[model samples]
Target chain A: MKKRSALIIIFTLIVGLSGLSSKTFAETAKNNYRLYCSQCHGLTGNGEGIDKPTMGVAPKIHNNAEEMIKLKDADIYTVTAQGGASVTKSALMPPWEGVMSEAEIKDMVKYLRELCNCTEK
Target chain B: MKMTKLTCLILFSLALTLPVRIAAAGDGKTIIEKNNCGTCHKMEGPAAKTFAEALSRKAPDLFYAGSKFQEEFLVEFSQKPYQIRPAGTLYLNHVKTVDGVDRIQDPPLCASRLSKEDAVLASKYLMTLKDPDMKIGVYKPGASFFKIGAKMIFTKSVACIGCHQVKKRGKIVGGTSGSSLYNAGSRLNGDWLSSYIRNPHYWDPMSPMPKWDLGEHAWMQLTNYIMEMKE
Candidate 1:
């Protein structure tokens, strides 16, 4: 009876956790990039996103080391969390504060630096 | 023993006739099941709880079909279905790196080609699946509202135009990330639209749609404007 119960519990655990993944959330900055940022920012963060053609104001290319290097780390964090419109940019870039945690946003700022391969000058 | 045998024969005959009665009556559900619509669309919920589960979903939930869509639209759409969301359902799944440039691919359009009679019957069954939580009659068709103001809010204030496609002076313009709202007035129920705008996560917990902190008037104005779009 004990062996059968243990097997049942193990099966239930596998089935219950099948589609559920923390990887889908903002657990890692790379996962977060795929989840929310990839649609508009492009998978490479090159601003060649699928939505670029229709957007009134193009999404800024995050991978451009020169352009990205001009902005401070705090500025990047602000735009990522508070949105572009808050800093006199496009309203098309909606805020992600509701969707991501502070730590996650901070991590994304770091990720953007990594994507650009440059730090703020 | 003879009487018992007779009763069994009678029962068997009744069972054989039950399907005939159901066919004559509205067996629209049977038609839907026969076509296996559940293979794609979710017919029941407790919706997907996690983002991963939501992403894995192949089609929209049909459990609350009655509350979301108009009967006429549903009936017609089932017969001649087109892709409404330009980026496909869960755009993440369809994004492809084509020629080193990321491009969006089209999701398969429905090819069911249901007969008019079957479409009507199936819609009748779908229209019966209402969500009690959704409050109806929030938007009145003939109510006084300003389109210019509503348009301004949609395109500028909340920037819904960033994702949803809308008509612009006979031109099909605006982003295609979200479902096109060009025919929203005729396609969607007003109450459901209002509720969804306030909180899309209410219906789809893992939806990436941003809920703006706009005033009540702005929200209603946006709803009124969207509900004005047709055909």
Candidate 2:
């Protein structure tokens, strides 16, 4: 009976630790988004950042879950990492490969999914 | 005779110390601090934490002043400040409606003006805050490649023309969100421009400019194109 309780305790601790780590990851991703994307993408991902009005072309609204749901994760990652120009989109979304690490880029993609409340296919 | 000799020795010591005192009296850092320049300007890094704070920033980051500005320009501009960004640094905040017409507000005149002597000292001190990571001659594309770079800047790669005003067909064109790059060739150092283009946040953490992961060749070409935009 004690061994079983100990196993249960270890399982609970593992789950709790994982939950905490994911929360920290999300927080980091949010900070990164604020640093790099929020300037043009807006703090709420509504595509109404201060630079939006001044931009020659409007940035895509990330808050629109319906639209975001249709986009593939790979496509979104490509746009974020390689820039909009790589996919024949706006050049205003400059590449982040030089500025951010691959792990960070992946985190940003995951954050974007969370922002839109969409699940990967 | 002994009293006369003592007087001569005192005079010699005083003469030796006068020049040193005069030279050390006008320390630029002291003058900047005395004027409370840090209240408006960012002398160091790790930009504002929040968007509101970033938007509220009044003056440009001066940490890279050593690497970015020409000494003569710095000295002259400090004494007689002029508008560098026509749209103001935070242009979005300056937009206002006057008489049912929307217009961009004029930037405030630089409140801090230094005398010629103080300006020289300040400029000298500012020029010492160079980014040690930046090395010259990393990329030096020749005049022949300027046309290709111009094309890339306009349409192909990073669309700098989308935000910054550039000369096209003898007419200033492009967005007003950023500082006009029409005279960047004369106003900015090529090395500084290259570093800024590669990673703007390195110079100013709150920079709204997006990072471009252009290869060295591409960035070099863009740099050449920008430097060709002389007065």
* Per-model DockQ: 0.33, 0.22
Clashing pairs in 2: none
Candidate that scores best on DockQ: 1
Candidate 2 regions exceeding 4 Å error are A1-28, A53-57, A114-121, B1-27, B44-58, B80-110, B137-144, B167-179, B201-210
B53 Cα displacement, candidate 2 (Å): 8.8
Quote the true-contact fraction of every model: 0.44, 0.27
Per-model TM values vs. the true structure: 0.82, 0.67
Q: Candidate 2: lDDT over CA atoms?
A: 0.73
Name the weakest run of 10 consecutive residues (lDDT summed) in model 2 chain B: B95-104
Q: Give me the candidate number with maximum lDDT.
A: 1
Clashes of each: 0, 0
Docking class of 1: acceptable
- Candidate 1 lDDT tens digits, A58-86: 88888999899999999999988888878
TM accuracy, model 1: 0.82
